[model samples]
Target: MALSLLTPNSLTKIPLTKLRFVPSLSPPPPPPPRAASVSFRRLSIMSSSNGIKVGAAQMTSTNDLDANFNTCSRLVQEAAAEGVKLLCFPETFSFVGMKAGESLQIAEPLDGPTMRRYCSLARDSNIWLSLGGFQEKGPDDAHLYNTHVLVDNYGNIKNIYRKIHLFDVDVPGNMTYKESDFTTAGTDIVAEDSPIGRLGLTVCYDLRFPELYQQLRFQHNAQILLVPSAFTKVTGEAHWEILLRARAIETQCYVIAAAQAGKHNEKRESYGDSLIIDPWGKILARLPDRLSTGIAIADIDLSIVDAVRTRMPISEHKRLESCQKISSLSSL
Candidate 1:
C-alpha cells in the first residue's frame, strides 16, 4: 500500500470492533485548556493470547542533566510499577542545551557515564527502555550522532539506531533549523526483536519519510515502529498525529512516539503529544495537552498486527516495481 494513499479520511474509514485499554494502567491526566485537544478513537483491538505493555513519554528537557534524569527516573518507576515491560522516552531525554554548541560540547560515547546512568536506571527499575536521540560522540570532533539506544531489562545495551534523516528544513514564516550542522546522519536502517515485538527504530525527521518505514515493515519485518522526536511546535501541530496514524495504517504496525513537549530553552520548543497507536490506526493513548510531561501507556498485541495484515494484506499486494523503487531510492 502506498503511504500517500492513506489520508485523514482513511483514519475514519478503518473498521473497528473491539477497543480495549490495559485494565491496570490508568489514563494520563487531562491536558491543560490551552493545549490543542486530539480526540482519539477508542476502537477495537485484535485478540491476543499475550501482549506487552509499553509507555511513551513526553517531557521538556533542559541543559540540566540531573533534572532530566530525575524526570526520567520518576517516569521509569511509574511505568515499571504499572507492569510496563518497555518504556520509550523522547529525543534529547538527557539534556537539551540552551546554546548551539552545548550538545556538541557534551556528546558522549555510547558507554559513557551519561549512558551508564540510564542503563543503571533500567537495571534498577527492571524495565526495558528506549532512550531516543542521545547525542553520541561521532567519528569527527565537530559532529555528534543523534543515537537511539535500547536497553534490555537486564540493563544491557540491546540495539542502537542513529537517526538517518536530519532536520534541515526552512519552514516558511518559522525559523530554519539545521540538524546536520552538529549531528551526523546515520547510514544503516535498524530493527530488532524484543519482548514487545520486532521493533523498527527512527528519530524525528525520519517520521516524515515513509520509505524508511516501508523498508522496516517490508524488509526488516518490524511489528512496531518507534519515533522518538523533539518536533517543532509549528510542524508538530500540523503533521505529527496525521503522519503517525498514516504510518501505522499503512504498515499494520503499532507506533510508539515519545515526544519532547513545551519550551526547552529560548530557541527550542517541542510539540508534545506523546502517543501510542494500534495497527488499525486507532489511537490507543495520548496526552491531550500537546505540551505536558507525562507517559501514555498501551498494550502492544502482536495478534493485532497479524490480524490487520491478514485482513488488508498490503505487504502481499505491494507492487514489485514500487518495492524496487523504494529500495533503490532509500538505500543510501
Candidate 2:
C-alpha cells in the first residue's frame, strides 16, 4: 500500500481508536489541560500558543541518490503545505542498500549536494527539518559515518548528530549487520534549542537505551525527541511500538519517529510503522507497512508534559539509600 499524507484538520479528528497505549508500569495521574499555546517564527497560524504541529515522513530509498532526494523534496513540500512546523525523514534517507563497500563512494560532505538540497527545501518551505541518517564521507575515501542533519527554516545547519550506537548485531538465521566496520561512532550527545522548544536528536539504535531519553528530558529539558530509524523487519515488529510508547510515557515528551519501509535491494526489508506519540503515550498518528512513502501529522502540546510530570512526580521520587547500597556492593 502506498503511504498517504494526512492534513492537520483530518489528523486532529482521527479517533483515538486507532491509537494504542502501553500500560504504564506506574499508573499515570489524570491528564492536564487538553491544549496549550505555542509560537513559531515561520508558522504564523501555529503561533496561537495552543499547540505545535509536528510531522513524520516514511520513505523507501534505494541506491539512487537523485531519486531519493526528489522523493524527500516532494514529501517535505507536502508536509509544509499542510502547516507542519517541524518534519522528520527516515534514516538513511539518501541512499539505502548498495554493496557493503559502496557506501563510501556515495558518501557526501556536510555541505555537499544532499544537504544543500535539504537546506533549500527548508528555506523554501519555511519549516524546521530533520532528515534521517545520511552517509557522510570520513577522513579517507574509505570511511563513512551515518549522520543526522538538522536545518532551520532559514536553511542554516542547526546541528549534526552522528549515530552513537552503531547497529552491529547478528540476528539468528536472518541477517548480520556490522555498522562499525564501515562507520565511525559519534562521541557526543546533541540537544538543540529551537523556536518550538528544546529538541533532542538520536538515531535508530539509540532507541533501545532508556537512559539517553531520560537525560534528554530531565537534564536537557527536551520538549520533543526525534528518532529517525531504518529498523530491520524482525526487530521492529517485535519492539518498535512498545519501546517508543514506553519512552513517551516515561519521559512525558513527544516522540517523533520517521522510518524506512518496504523491501530494499535484494533481500533486506524495513519495518514501516512510522509514528508520533504524545506525552501521554498515545499513538497520535501512524503509517502502515510495505509502502514507498507515507506521512503522519500530530499536534504536540508542551503543557501536557508539565501536567503529567506534576501529577505523577515520579522523576522526583528518588531513593539515595538504595543507590548507595548498589554503589557499595560494586566496590566489593
Candidate 3:
C-alpha cells in the first residue's frame, strides 16, 4: 500500500518498500575519548575471551637493590589491581648498578633470594610477568649474563633469555656502554609459550637487530615480541619508537617494550618511552616520555596478528638465500 501525505498545497504518495532513507551528509560525530593515554582502536578487547590484558611497566632503577625491589613490587601490585594478566618490567630491573663492577656483586643464581621473591609476587598476585634484565651469575666467575625471564601465573619460570647482542657502542656525548666487558652473550635464541601467546624474548641492544625479531616471528611462530630495555638518551630519543614499530610491522605481531626511564645514577640516564605497539604498528599505549614511571595496560588480540599476516603473506615471500648473500657481501 502507498502512504499518502496531504499538505495545504499538495499531496504526495510513496511506497514504503520502494522508498530509501538517506543519511545526513554531515561527517559522523568523532569517537568518544579514552581514559588510557592512547588506544589505537579505542576498542576495549580486555574482557574478550581470546583477548589478553597486558601491561608494560617502565622503571628508574638504581644501585640499591632493596629500593629497586620496592619499586618493582609497587608496579606489580598496580598492574595486578588493574587486572593485567601479564606485567612486563624494564631491563636491569633487579638492579642497575652504579659501576659495571657492581653487577658482579649483585648477579645471582637463577634461584636467588630476589628471584624467589619475584616468584612469590607473581603467584600471590596471580599475574604472569616479564621479569626482564636480571644480572645472572655465569659459571667459572668470568662474566655475568643479562637475563630476561617469563614467569607464569603460577609463578613458575617458563622461559629465560640471556641477551645475545651486547651493546658495545660509543655514542658521542650522549653515552658510551661496553656491555661485553661485564656480560657474556647468550648462544641460543629463546622463543617459548605463555598464557597470552607464543612469546619471543630479547633485551635492550637486541632491538637494533631485526633478524632476531624476524626469526622469532617466522621461524619460531612467536606472536608477541618482548623488548625490555635500558636504552640510552641519544639513541632512544631518535630510534626507540620507530625501531619498535618497524619490528611489529615487519613481524606482524605485538611488540611490548618495557623500558628504563630517567637517571639511574650519577653516571647514566635512560630515554624512557615504554610502548605497546600492535601488529599494524599502531601505538596502543605509551608512557609518553622518559620521565614517566608506571604501568600501561592494553588488550592483546592475537586474531589481529593472524589477520594481518594472512592478508599480507610476507612470511611466504621472504628470501633467505638472497639475504644471506647480502650479509656475506657486507661482511667482505
Best by TM-score: 1
- Candidate 1 residue runs with Cα over 4 Å from true position: 1-49, 322-332
Model 2 error, position 284 (Å): 0.5
Worst 10 residues of 2 by lDDT: 38-47
What's the number of clashes in each of the models?
Answer: 5, 4, 0
Best candidate (score: lDDT): 1
**Candidate 2 Cα misplacement greater than 4 A, ranges:** 1-49, 288-292, 320-322, 329-332
Query: For model 2, what is the alpha-carbon lDDT of residue 136?
Result: 87
Task: Report the alpha-carbon TM-score of model 3 versus the true structure.
Answer: 0.82
lDDT of 3 by residue, 37-127 (tens): 3221111123224567898887788898887778778888878777788989989988888876898987898898988889888999999
Clash pairs for candidate 3 = none
Model 1, residue 76: displacement in angstroms? 0.3
Model 2 Cα lDDT, one tens digit per residue, 1-332: 11111333222232232233323233323323322221111111121135777888887778888888887888788788887888998899888866778778878899898789889989999999998798889867667878989899999999988888889999776689989888988877888998767888999999999988888887888878999999998898678888999888888888988888766678687876677877767666664332437577766666656666676676788566689999999999
Q: Give the Cα lDDT of each candidate.
A: 0.82, 0.76, 0.78
lDDT string, candidate 1, 218-258, tens digits: 99999999999998878987888889989998898999999
